[model samples]
Target chain A: MMKTSKIPILKLYNNLLISIQWELDDKTAMQFQEDLLKKIHETGATGVVIDLTSVDVIDSFIAKILGDCVNMSKLMGATVVLTGIQPAVAITLIELGIELEDIHTALDLEKGLELLKELED
Target chain B: MSLKISGIVEFIRMHRDEIMKDWIDRFNKADAQSISAESDQIDQAIAAEYVNILIEWSKNKEDEFSRKIHEFSKRIVQLDWPMDKIAQCLHTFEKILFAKLLEKQIPGDPLELLSEIEKVTSPVNREVFLQYTSSYERTINLQKMALQELSAPLIPVFDSITVMPLIGTIDTDRAKRIMENLLKGVVKYRSEVVLIDITGVPVVDTMVAHHIIQAAEAVRLVGAKSLLVGIRPEIAQTIVNLGIDLSQITTKNTLQKGIEAALEMTNRKIVSMGERR
Candidate 1:
């Protein structure tokens, strides 16, 4: 059996914070998607902030999975905010033709939380 | 073969003064403006040095001949002598030297003398042109580097707001540079809003519009909003005429309005002190 490491999801107030600290493989990404949705469902969090400050090298498949995760969280009534995306990663994603439109983005975790608060109002 | 080579070398040495005088006269007639622009003494000195180098090279000072030719070409190029002027100088010298060779009887066949003269003169001509073009290419490369350095500069005008004023036409290479610099500046400055002022840009065709839209989209992905500013009246007309969908991006007619909107987006505005007083 291959050990699949799960991305930890922390709950704070009515929002869930996830910081991807390493490069995610396909299996790990899929697991993270399922785990995040489960956490959103269990906690009934109204906002989610996914921080990719430490993570690098997101391929097209990983980008698609992230987009799917954002949409899935939205379907469950949680607003998703992506934070701390590196410049290289942003350029790569743009070059790959994945705009990730309609997704909220912030400079850092503090800004991401502030954006979520603004949306709540 | 050795005797023939020495004979041609001896002939040039014997008539060296005559050759120098004739070359200078013909060169002055051919390029009078350039010659008179400088002092007559400097032109005479250069021509004298050129004839001396040819005489030395024919006498079998191969290494010194090449080094002197290299330095001579570099000096003339720096002096901004036109390539045609240099060619004309070489042609006049060759004609004078061959005429001297033909006028005086030598031990070798006429064809052999012609070929030997060709061997000596052709290399110098080729070397001069080679140096000229290489220097020209070097200048072009330097200017290109300078232009690239000046291409995309991102300035942080206010807190959390940056401005990138683009001048000149935006080609694919420059567009790619603009996008990279804009995105990198946003992250580095932690800007919430960016204003791209294209007032200096003369033309906005469909391709340029597409690049702008892509840059705006990339900025959005990087967590900053991009506002296209400095749209001239004609640019606005062309944008609509081309059917470019700039509706998705916020654009202002001038940079001043763009800055105001940027400040407003960042939840701050400049209030006049006179009104408060």
Candidate 2:
């Protein structure tokens, strides 16, 4: 069995920044979800920006988990902002007919933070 | 030996005018029934130059004759003459000249001289035919490029809002172009909302809907919202009948409503002034 490293969720100015730089296998994605929730609870952050700039492929299962994470975070009173979704990934998700309607998306990390700020305001 | 050929060449050259007049008369009579007015003018103007080139086709003037034929072929293509007519005219010129030489009894072997004449005019046919096909290929390529340019056009209508009005039938290749142009326009225009007006689109099938959905998602990914406008009653029915889910993306019945929605998204609105007070 190959070992998996945990996806780190960094804390920056009361918001969590998770820039996924590698492909997420099923196990790593689930682990990342759990760790993110734990970190959100520990820091009590109200906004989370998950950047998928480097992620190219996203299957339905991974997409479902990501959607669930947004809902879960919202339940905890934190607004989640998905940022830096590449063109190819957007096309793939659309082709798969997986529209994360409940989720808010931004062009990049900068815009994501601004969107979060706007929502807070 | 060469002097006899030159003498014969001079003899043929002396009767050039009579040969040209008869040939043109015959050629024009044969084609007058079918020739258009514009083409008749071109044929009249080009006949003199064509006769000159044919008359000068001999050992000393072979190079000049070839060059003239090249120019004549280019002109014929520009005039839009049929390929068969060009070859026929050249053969007619040869037959007329050969007959004239025999009637005049020029001092040379008629068979040998006929073979010599063949050498000159054969290139004329080959060159004209080559030029004809190349010109056709060029025209086709130019038209294809023009069609591609007219295919997809993204126009910015307002501040932070752009509209891409689509018309005609949608195919996969055109859809791909639409997607690329949408994403590029979104970033370039810094548009917060994009209204895709499909009033001119005739029919929308599952494939077209899928493409539009994909384009909308791509627009969303680029940080702009896409609002589909101009969904006719029949199109709506087709969507429902096909069981296609378009609920995720906001849609409107007309471009006006879509623009209004876009304005609202960008926190703006058009206010109608009461009157000049």
Top of the candidates by DockQ: 1
Is model 1 an incorrect, acceptable, medium or high docking prediction?
medium
Clashing residue pairs in candidate 2 are none
Stretches of candidate 2 above 4 Å error? Answer: A1-9, A18-46, A51-80, A86-103, A117-121, B1-22, B34-45, B51-69, B82-122, B237-245, B273-277
lDDT of 2 by residue, A72-114 (tens): 9999888999887776677778778888876888877887898
* DockQ of prediction 1: 0.70
Residue-level lDDT of model 1, residues A14-77, one tens digit each, is 9999999999999999999999999999999999999999976889999999999999999999
Query: What would you estimate as the lDDT of candidate 2?
Result: 0.84
The local distance difference test score of each candidate is 0.88, 0.84
The 10-residue segment of model 1 chain B with minimum total lDDT is B31-40
Say which candidate scores most in lDDT: 1
Clashes of each: 0, 0
- Candidate 1 residues B1-277, lDDT tens each? 6566556667778888888888888777766765564556777888877767667776557787788889887777776777887788788887888888878755567787877877767767788899999999999999999999999999999999999999999999999999999999999999999999999999999999989998998888778899999999999999999999999899999999999999999999998777554
**What is the TM-score of candidate 1?**
0.91
